[model samples]
Target: MKVALLYNQKPDLPENTPKYQSDEFAEWDNPETIDAVANALRERCDVVKIDCNPAYLQQIITTLLEEKPDICFNITEGIGEPSREAQIPALLDMMRLRYTASDPATLCLALDKARTKEILSYYQIPTPHFRVIHSLSEGMVFLNEHHQFPLIVKPLHEGSSKGIFERSVVYSVEELSRQLREVIEQYKQPALVEQFLSGREFTVALIGNGETLEVLPIIELLFDHLPKDSRKIYSYEAKWLWDDPENPVEVFKCPAPISKELADEIASLCKRAFRALRCRDWARIDVRLNEHGKPFIIEINPLPGILPNPDEHSCFPLAARTAGIDFNALINRVLDEALKRYNLAI
Candidate 1:
C-alpha cells in the first residue's frame, strides 16, 4: 500500500494586511503526527507527504493523480476561505480517489456549526440552541431575545477553539453584544452565539466502518482547579495560551468517571451522529452535560488531533490507549477500515 498526506500549508489573513493580499498562516497538519501515522503505515505500506495548500488545490489534484497512491491519509485543514477544510476532500471526491474521514459534503456541513446543529437536531441529537449572527446589528437584536443569560460566542467557521477565549463567555446582554461586535470585527465573519450549558465535558472517539464502528472510551475535562466564577469552556487561551505562564484550564482526564448507563447513552448518541454524517476512518464527538446531567453535544470534530502524547490533553489517543490499542495499532485499525471501504487487500 502507498499513502499520501493532504494538508493545508498556508496561514490565515494577517491582521494588518487587506483581506485580498494578506500573508497566509502555515498549517501542515503537524509533521510529527503525520510521521507517526506514516511510520505505522510503513510496517505494511509506503507513505509520502503531500504538503497541500488550499490555494493550490489544482496543483494538489494534479500531483495526487500523478502519484496514484493506494490511499491518502487526509489531514488537510484548508486555509483562507470558509470551505478551506473541504477543498482537498472535494478534489478527492471529484477525482474518485479514496481518502479518510467524513466525505466532502459532510466536511462542509460539519465545518458550518449552524448547519451541523440543524442536521443533528433533525436527527434528534441533543445540542444547544444557537443563532448565526451575520452582523453586529443582528446580534444586538438577537441577544435581546432567543438567548438566556450567560451565553458563549465564537467565530462560526473556525475550529480548534480559534477566536474563543475567556471573554467569549457572557453573563449579560450588554456583554454578549460587546463580544459579538468584537468577534465580528476581528474574525470578519458571522458569530455563533450559543446557549451555554455549564457542566462536565467529554469527548467520544469513534473508529471503523459502517456496521463495525467502535466508540472508544469517554474522555473528560476535569475542572477541579477552575474557579467558580469562570466558565468551563475549552477556549483559545485554555487550548493554546502556553506562554502566559499563568494559564488555567486544568489537565484533561481520560477514562472519564461516569455511571455505565450515562456512558452508554453518550456512546450511542455519538455513534448515531457519526453514522448520520457518514464519518469514516475516525472522528471525535464532543459532548457536554447540562446541569441536569443530560448529554448536549458541543460539536463533532471530524479531524481530531492525534499528538504524540497519551496523557496531556490528547483525548482521542488516550481513549485509543484505554481500549488497549497502542498508537501504531490504532493507526493500523483506521487504515484497515479505510482499505475495507475501498475494497482493497490490506
Candidate 2:
C-alpha cells in the first residue's frame, strides 16, 4: 500500500514584511511534523511527502497522477481563500482520489465558525449565542440590543487561534469595537462575536466513524499561571509563544478531573457535533461549560494541528497520549480509520 502525506509548507516571508505579519503567516506545518508523519507511515506503507502550496500545486497533481498512491493523508491548510482547507479535497474529488479526514463540504462548513454553530443549533446541540459582524459599526447594534457584555470576538474564518489574542475577550463596548475592527482589518473577514462562557473549557479528541468512533480523554485548559488581567482564552500567544516544553506552564490537564456525569455529557456533545458536521476519520472539538455546568460546543477542528514535539502544547496529541496512544500509534490509527471508511483496510 502507498500513502501520500500532504501538508502545507509555509513559504519564506518577503524581506520587507514586518515581524508580526510574518509571524502570522507562518501557520503552516513545520518540517518536524511532516517528517514525523512520514516516519510513522513509512513503517506501514510506502510514503511520500507532497507540498500543498498553490505555487507547487501543479507539481503535486502530476506527482499524484503518476504515483497513484492508494490514499492521501491530507492535512493541507490552504494559504488563501475562506474555503482554503477544502480546496485540496475538492481537487482530490475531481481526480477521484481517496483521502483522509472530513469531506470537502464538511471542511468548508467547519472552517466557518458561524455556519458550524448554525448546524449545531439546527441539531439542537448547545453552542454559545454568536453574531457575525462584517464591520465595526454593526458591533454597536450587537452591544445595544439584548446581548451580553463579556463577549469574545474572533475572525469568522480562521483557526489555530490566528486572529485570537488576549484582548479578544472584551468587557466593554469600546473594547468590542476595537477588537471587531482589528479582526476586520487584520484578517480581512467578518468577526464572530460569541457570548463568553465563563465555566471550564475543555477539548475533546475523537477517532473513527459511526458506531465504532472512539472518543479519547478530554483536555482542560489551565489559566492559573496566566497574568492576573489575562482572560482565560487559549490565545495565539499562549498556544505558540508561551507554552515551552522545557519551561512548561502546565497549560493542559488531560482526563480533566470531572465527574462521570459531566464527562459523559461532554463526550456526547463532542460526538454529536462531529456527526452533525459530517466529520470523518478524526477530529478535535472544543467545548466550554456555562456557569450552570452545561457544556456548549465552541468549535470543531476536522484537520486538527499535530505539532511533533512532545512539549509543544498540541491538544489532540496530548489527549491521545493521555489515553495511552503514542504519536506513531495515533498517526496510524487515523490512517487506519480512513482506510476503513473506504473499505481499503485488509
**Which candidate should be chosen as best, given lDDT against the real structure?**
2
Residue 334 local lDDT, model 1? 82
Give the per-residue lDDT digits (tens) of candidate 1, residues 164-280.
Answer: 888999988888888899889988989998988888899999998788999998888765655465567777655555313245344666688899999999999999889877777
lDDT digits (tens) for residues 25-95 of candidate 2: 45588788989999999988999889988888789899999999999999898867778889999999999
Please give the lDDT score for candidate 2: 0.88
**Reference-based lDDT, residue 172, model 2:** 85
Which pairs of residues collide in model 1? 10-25, 11-24, 11-25, 11-26, 12-25, 78-84
Task: Give the clashing residue pairs of candidate 2, or none.
Answer: none
Error at 321, model 1, angstroms: 1.1
Query: lDDT per prediction?
Result: 0.78, 0.88
Clashes of each: 6, 0
Off by over 4 Å in 1: 9-27, 54-59, 242-250
Tell me, what's the RMSD of every candidate? 4.0, 2.1
lDDT of 1: 0.78
